[model samples]
Target: MNSLVLIAVGLLGILSGWFFYSRFIAARIYQLDAQFRTPAHEFRDGVDFVPTNRYVLWGHHFTSVAGAAPIVGPAIAVIWGWGPAFLWVVLGTIFFAGVHDMGALWASVRNRGQSIGGLSEKLLGSRARWMFMLIMFLVLLMVNAAFATVITNLLIQFPTAVIPVWGAIVVAIGIGQLLYRAQVGLLWPTIIGVGLLYGLILLGNAVPVALPAEIFGLSDRVVWVLLLFLYAGIASTLPVWMLLQPRDYINGIQLFVALGIIYAAALLSAPTVVVPFINDQVPAGTPPIAPLLFVTIACGAISGFHGLVSSGTSSKQLDRETDARLVGYGGAVGEGMLALAAIVCATAGFATLADWQAVYTNFGAGSVGAFVTGGANIVSQGLGIPAGLAATILTVTAALFAGTTMDTGVRLQRYVIQETGAITGIAALKNGTLATLLAIGFCLAIAFGAASDGTGGMVIWPLFGTSNQLLASLTLLMVTVILARLGRPVVFTLVPLVLVLTMAIYALLLQIGTFLGDQNWTLAIMALFILGAAIMVGISAVTALRQTGFSLLAHRHPAE
Candidate 1:
């Protein structure tokens, strides 16, 4: 089948979800109130709690939750065949991710902007909250430290991307000043910002910037790591309007433009999908497609991490309660679109099935590498751009994604720290500056302390997939409990909650065995411990759901 077939179907289904189903959920279920006061206004500190334009908030939430996962996940999941991955990315985003993300935003907005973890404490008990928060802290640590290395390596490999990638920071700051300080409309700033960013991309293509072998005796990679962390620390602490909002907003626009390039390329080129619809030929020890596909493609289809971004940052910036449908659910749809594009690039870029098989020797063989390689080829062929320049554009786009995710992760980690301090009664931890210091300090330690070369952040990378999905499941559980409390329909949240928890736990168990076989005690023990914590939280959820004001707790009745 042609790659355009997949793009056409995916777009149709995704748009239908946004237009028809999301409207239904908004009116009949979520009942979003346009006049309702949002926490962005209620707690407008301007630092973390500034009320934002819905378009800008959607951009922030979309890019923050995006990372490299949506691209990586679908690209890798093409091993099973593009069909299954395509279905999951499309259907899962609409039913599972869209609802979960929107519900988390709504629940948080309704509860005075408490985090999903904080909501867990009130509904599922303190123990559950502790478990929930621990998982999130580890996930954030994985993101911040690992992404610093990811961005550094990308800069080193694609020197042409460096200029545009760093140049975007200056452009975003100017946009922020125009939008907030000058009080101008978003239109001019968006157009000018995107134009300048792409111009940087063109200039970068002309004058590639390469770092020296060493900067003051430290390796170039180490210097980049330090610089990245330093920037994240300061930028994350700035007011939302100053940096985070505009930076992510522009990056989001750039990414959509990139996606549009790929989609148009697929439409024009009409490249044949080289991979099989279903790979009946077994690749030796490939894991069963059942639960593994779900975990493998978490972010593109559904993610627990989205819940963190939603409740942690997005809910705080929501200008109106009604905007949750657009920001929360719409952000997820944006991710789904990215994933669909990934599936197309991975499957159709190669000349034949044999070419794809050479790369897909195992379950995790193809990720960002496949996405970039395949995407550059398609872009070059369809747009008449040189291969090297096309590659640079895609590379810079991917690096920007990782950078924005790190920004959000650093800030979210700080939130986790402050929340932990309040719960533990540590006055110092509750202070914003202190907590941010602790957050950055811990990430730096993980990067430098654990390894001589500042690559220790990768040690915990293996656990990110399972732990993240489990956390998503728990967030759904939190939402389910909240819906129960409100005496509203529970089916929307409840079913996805059950499905994600099952798949994530099953995948976690599988990883434990793999870790044990590989003699990776560090991963094995950590996975086992996380599994135990998840079970406890699940039990807590069950109890919370059962004890709900009698009948509601028993799910409307014992015999229902």
Candidate 2:
């Protein structure tokens, strides 16, 4: 298990697939027409559907897809040895994720930028539209909860994280004001923003103020959770271009820079890989690859949440059908690369195999966070920075990344609630403000319970993967249904559909067993949620098959 080899394999996987297959081959197979009426044209609006440069759209799409999931997934998957993690990520991105994302984009373009829920209704049924939206709402709630826990922990663990976190917000505000209000172009402001943000980072180090070490007479984790939801309440209601999009752009740049620094460190150190491929010695009842792997590693491979971004926000901004390949397919690959970079940092840059083993053995599966933070410290140390400051900055960056994820999850949840209200004839719930408030309440409740139990850390990893994979499964199902309606080759959609379903079902079963065995009240409640998801998936699949069969029969006969 050579760490460098694993890194090389990951890089090679994305590069070869992106260039040769995704761009050249799959792009053509989709037969995306340049002259087609895109959602930008059909639903032309200033906010969502607007023709824009492909690169800018790529930035938008990439940021929307890249989040804590990628980092967390690879970090946890490394626990099983990088072999399984690397294989799943590389192959999963190439075959399952790339196809699912691109297909969603294509379907949206053809259907005038309708969301996955909308598309499901058109192709599957009106019932499916509601069912899908409900699943999405639950998925997002879990996502928000998990991410909140991760970011909150990081922020508390390292006081230095506040610097980059605040720096990002300040930078976003300046850039957003310039672009939206002042009507200034993005180029100059972006450059200035990055520089100013970096300067602020230095200032933060010079004048570091430790956060009040207590809140609500609870641990820092509890206080952080409360503060995060308070932030989410305000952030989710704001315009995307204001804080979300601009902040994402800044984060995107930071992510790229961090990745470069990490890769450079890995190249310099080239430490041997100590984690074994199959730790047969792992204790029984040690939840390694069963339920944990599926949820823990959600972002890098397949995320149903990506579907929400694809159909919800990204589709509205698509300028052309061809750009879908770049935005959708390319975005997934970018995330996969980010995950690979994390793997390299975790595995290749360790001082020694013994140290890596010690961290894992001592910390158990949760070591991924410390591994990454330590890796960042190693890079900072190599760069001659004081280890304390370096570690602090790294922790803050991770926390900020997690915050972005939580914010996005909250926003998506609001959308889901609104849509659900609309379908359920709940007129009072139709107001965007009310829906948003409801979302905030739900998020806060989950966060509160998670924090109070001190099991917040425990839930984040396992549920993260299951929720995300289920999202992927639903996305694939919707895409398959729509592709079937379009009269495309069913085989193309079938392969990914089956793959997602299989992984999701297997993961869900494992989750059910784990939860039931644990017998904790929270675990039991979550197990019910997992069970419900399994049922929904089963019903959705059966419904899709029946509808496809009926459509085929109708097509074959002139009259029924």
Candidate 3:
């Protein structure tokens, strides 16, 4: 396929979803009202549910939703061929993600910004509330662990990355304090932060840190992972206004800027799309089309994890129901654009298929980071910057991006564990600090296990996708139940509900089988989790069907 045509198709997919399906859902089914008082009004808490302008909410929503998952998933998916990867991204965003996000926001709005867990209980049953929380905790733990490894690996491989990475963190904290505590507006702080961060990058090249070949006789990977968690722990403990929100705003802008540069380069060069639409080179027994592609590219298309962000953080800040369309629907499209950029970078900039394959073989799992850094290098070359410096800057930026994701993942995991403990009446686990520590411990254990296995834990990628998708499926089911209760049209909710559940279950089964055969402790733990998820989904589906049937019957009979 021609590169330009492929790129156009990807953009068209995003636009179609944004304009057609998302708009329709926002206006017709959700019937979002600008006049209605949102949860931000009803709850009115300064922390979570403060009323904010749609623009500010957009910043929050974008940051919360955009993370390592979108980048990592697309990078891996492109290995199969950009065609299937791009197709899933486009179609999945339109039908699956748009629906999932809009539904979550709508449900949250109706329920006064109560989380998905609470909404599930109100709509599905008390059991679903517990199941949702449990699944969310496990998923967050895996997300934190996986991205923790990814970030640490990148940092270890490129020691110079620490300069800009730490600089960004420091600048973010300063900006956060200025904006929130010092009563300074966002304008000055952001401008100053960006400038300072760039300056730090230049200085970093002058005086780079040179560590011993090993730290404490441990591999560089191990040291990096420990430092990353330590950083996450501190970041998570800070007030949202002071660190989390400001860092997210900076990261969000950087993401867009990087994307613009990459896209401009692609269009100018108009590189050939060398990757095949369907590669016969794919190893046998790998289902090239349906199940594997669907699971592998989960985040770009329709991440269930987005549901957590939508309901957990973004929903609480929405100023009105109408804002849901912008935050929920628009956020998904933004992520789709990120995925598209990854595809373009992987395909368009490569000189040939041979070069692409060489990078994949040489860098191994690090090919995605290398590809992106190379893209940055190409842009730098085209713009007359030193390629080495440019690549180092880009690599550091990617590391920072991954770091932010890990921070949020850790916090989400803590919330999940604490909430689960509360619901389960586990007094020992109810302390927030204790729960947070346990959450971190769980993630560290997974990372250590994966590292020791020497497989680099690429096998865990599919499991992450499955867990994320299942979360989305469960969220959709909850949305359907809520709509049914609220007497809204169930057709929209029902269709996507079935689709996500089917995809999630198929993916889970594949994971369970793979894990069972592996028989390792990590895989075994994953298998047990998958089995529990399977049962929860089955039970939830049956209950939802029965509830829908009763609603239909009652409507027809005008119940006595």
Best by lDDT: 1
Which tens-of-lDDT digit does each residue in 1-560 have in candidate 1?
Answer: 98888888899999899998898888867889999999999999988888999999999999999988898889988899888999999999899999989999999999999999998898888988899898889888988888888788789888999999999999999999999999999999999999999999999989999889888899888988998998999888899889899999999999999999998877778889999888887488889898889988988889988999999999999999999999999998999999998899899988788988898888788787788889888988888778788888888888999999999999999999999999999889998888889999999998998776778787777788889899999988888777776666778888888888899999999999999999999889989989988899989998887766433223343223
Q: Candidate order by TM-score, highest to lowest?
A: 1, 3, 2
RMSD of each: 2.3, 3.5, 3.4
Candidate 2 on 1-560: residue-level lDDT in tens?
55567777788988788887787535444667777777776777654456655655666666666656677667756767767777778887887777778877787777777777767776656765666676777777777776777776666666556666766787887777787679888788777876776676677667665567676677666766767787877777776667766777767666666667666666665656666775455534457575456556666777888888788777776777888888888888888887776666566546665666665662145444755555665576456556666565556556666777676777767777776777788987877789878997887666666557343544544565665677677777666565555544555556766766676667767766767787755665765665575566558656766565534212232112
Error of 1 at 219 (Å): 1.7
lDDT of 2: 0.68
lDDT of every model, 2 decimals = 0.89, 0.68, 0.71
- Given candidate 3, what's the lDDT at residue 330? 83
- Misplaced by over 4 Å in model 1 are 549-560
Candidate 3, clashing residue pairs?
Answer: none
Considering only N, C-alpha and C atoms within 3 Å, which residue pairs clash in candidate 2? 161-396, 295-465, 295-466, 304-471, 304-472
Q: What is the lDDT for 477 in model 3?
A: 76
Model 2: how far residue 481 lies from native, Å: 1.9
What TM-score does model 3 achieve against the real structure? 0.89
